[model samples]
Target: MSVNIMLYKITLVVYIAATILFLIDVLLRRTSLGNYARGTLLIGLLVHTATLATRYAEVGQTPVANLHEALSFFAWMLIGSYLLIDLRYRLDSLGVMVCPLAVIMLLAGGVIFYEVPHQNPMLDSWWFPVHVTLAFAGYAVFTLAFLVGIMYLLQERMLKTKSFSGLYYRLPSLDILDIINYRCLSFGFPLMTMAIITGAVWANQAWGGYWRWDPKETSALVTWFLYAALLHGRLNVGWRGRRAAIVAIIGFIFLIFSLFGVNLMLSDEHSFDAFKSLR
Candidate 1:
């Protein structure tokens, strides 16, 4: 096995270990285990970074044109974003939610898809990487927001019912989770907007049109509008707490469909095979 493949496997193993540790930390109330989980997560991130860099060196392009690379990159961005948030918020328990997601993404990327390196000239444009990176970064943050929203709903329910368990105590307060959700939306929305604009420009340059109304493009626009409305409601209508969380969760669902379902199931110019044909 090549070093890149080995690194990827190691990263996946580490991520799995980290996820288990995070779960144990949350369920068992082992505060000390949280520190170990964080350290393990950091190691996995470094290894995954190395794996991507190696693949990029070998492929001579951004390593995200294929499903394998795209999923791996998305997982990497998600973990990186979560670490940053944990650093700022000290919400180690959030790892219980995030680490498993990272593991699943990595597994989907590294295991489900056969790893083959091919260069597509259609992705040769400078804008392609920028567009994809910003778009996935936005997705990552929105994912974090969605997880926090779920936690908020659970915590709210526990509070209302007076069910106060260890899980309730371990999770951050509803207010804190809401603030994090809003912040994620604030960061992700502008990135998504820029991604759409860049995507249009790239599309026009490559395909001779700015707006194709392709399924992927249309779904992306719809996802964008969902978040836009969420933000608008938050700022103008003073939507917060449960309402904002619900909207954020709903927006993320649309985002998943835009990213995966449209690309895989729908016929569109944005599909991976279509890019090869364009080349």
Candidate 2:
């Protein structure tokens, strides 16, 4: 096997170890173990970055356009974003939620990456990278927001019922979690918009049309509209607390479906060519 494959395996092992450690840390409420988990996660991220760097060096371009490559990028962005938020908010429990998702994405990469050809042809312009990068980053942020929103709702429900469960004690305050969710969405929505615009431009360049109503395209549009409606409902329709939280959860479900579901069933450019095994 190649050195990159070896490094990739090492990274996956480290990530799985870190995830187990972090889960145990959270279950035991051990701050020291949480710190250990962070250290392990950092090491895993470093190894992951090196793996990607080697792949890019071999390919001689950004690896954001293809389905498997995009999945790998999304996993990396999730780790990076989680670390950033955890640093800012001291939300160690968030890692327990995030690391598993990243691992799944990375494992999925192991399956799909092989089906992808070794030689990635340039798309004739740099806008392809710009568009995909922004979209995946936006999706990453929204996913974080959605997780926080779920946590916020759970914490709030516990408080309302006066039940001090272990999960409630481990999670952050509802106010703080909601603020984090809102802030992430605030940043992510605009990035999603830029992605859409860049995509329209790229589409016009390649396909001679801007709006093709493809499965991935339409699903993304619906996801965007849902989030936009949530924003409007929160601002003007006086929807807050549970209602807003529900909207976020539903929006995220749709987004996930758009991300993986469409790719699995639909035959779009964004769909994975090797997705048969993914099912």
Candidate 3:
């Protein structure tokens, strides 16, 4: 636990430094500093992983069964996705957006460290880990796609308006953003499907039903349907650019509402009591 705390402190510090460096790099147009920011981000990711591993070993289970663990996992997923995309593409500008988000998520996770000793009874099954992990992984990818879509729209708008501001210059081309958005969604969609299937199976085992209209479950279904529509529109309608980008943005908004808003605003078996305590 002491080691985990130290790792958490290190992650928080590195994430803050990375965010500052990325922001400065963007403002000053320093690509070299952006490389330094990426290295800082890598350090943060390593420390965060070590902390989670330690927690898992201490707990004798995957730590994600509790609110604090889930929130930590969410932060890790964000950084992990960013690292993968950054390695694959020259998306340093994206780090300027994502690094701050990672910092916020990690800090929030740290602040909400109230210990809920017992796991939720509903989440006691073997598939729980697979379901939750895949769901969060899919969410992470969608989050990246959402940010890229935003950049695409902004760049396209700037082009149409003939405004060549610093942001316009800093962002990638709309075409490139569109391609990145599609690639992220393509990778995320299959993982989301697997999550849904595993979740349904877990539901059947725990609740004697496969599909309860619980708020969380319903919201997830709606988000899934929205993304499925986006995918279909892209495939059947040959929607490959700005239009597809818009759909991705909408899908991500719905995903956030489903993941956070629904759990806070409504009641359901999947609601894990983090709502009342803000943990």
Candidate 4:
């Protein structure tokens, strides 16, 4: 096997180990288990970073042109985001959601759609990395918000029914989850805005027009508007709790469809095949 593949497999193992530890910690509320999980996830992120770096060395450009590369990088960024959030919130419970998603992303990227690196001139632009980095970072933050949204809803329900479960015990209070949801929206909005702006610039350079109204573009625009409205509601009207959580979940679902579905299932200018057709 190649060095990249070797490292990816190792990282996947580490991520799985971390996820299991996190799950155990969630069930037991043991600080030691949470610490081990966090440490293991840190090691996995380092190894995954090496994998991306090595892929870049092998391929002459950023390693985000294909599903495997993009998903792996997405998982890497999610782990990084989770770590940063952990530094402040001590959100050990968040790991139960984040780590499993990371593991699934790594598995889907590495196993289902592994592709050999091929130089694509379309991805040669400096804008490619900049746009993708911002886009994925924004998505990572939104995913966190989405998970926190779920937690908020669960906590709310448990409180209303007065039937608290073990998972309920592990979850943060509704107030904290709502705060996290708003904070994530606050951070993700700007990154997503810049992603769209840089994307327009890149699209203008690559395509003949600034807007193609392609499926990806349309979905991105809609997703942008969705979050914009959510933020607007929070800032202007003071929307929070259940309403905010629901919107977050809806927005992320649309975002994922834009990211994966449009690329693989639907034809769009963003797809590799479409890129080749343009050339």
Per-residue lDDT of model 2, residues 77-189, tens digit only: 88887888888797877899998998898897776663334443436567777987898888888889888888888888899999888898799887778778777777888
Give the per-residue lDDT digits (tens) of candidate 1, residues 216-269: 888899999999999999999999999988998999999999988887676665
Model 1 ranges with Cα > 4 A deviation: 274-279
List clashing residue pairs in candidate 1.
Answer: none
Residue 58, candidate 3: how far off, in angstroms? 2.8
Report the lDDT tens digits of candidate 3 across residue range 41-93.
99989999998888876766667765567778888998899899889786888
Local distance difference test, candidate 1? 0.88
Q: Model 3: residues >4 Å from true position, as ranges? A: 114-116, 277-279
Q: Give the alpha-carbon lDDT of every model.
A: 0.88, 0.81, 0.84, 0.88
Per-candidate TM equals 0.95, 0.91, 0.94, 0.95
Minimal lDDT window, size 10, model 3: 114-123
Error of model 4, residue 170, in angstroms: 1.1
Give the number of colliding residue pairs in candidate 2: 0
Looking at candidate 2, what is the lDDT of residue 260?
A: 81
Between candidates 1 and 3, the one scoring higher on lDDT is: 1
Error of 2 at 189 (Å): 0.5
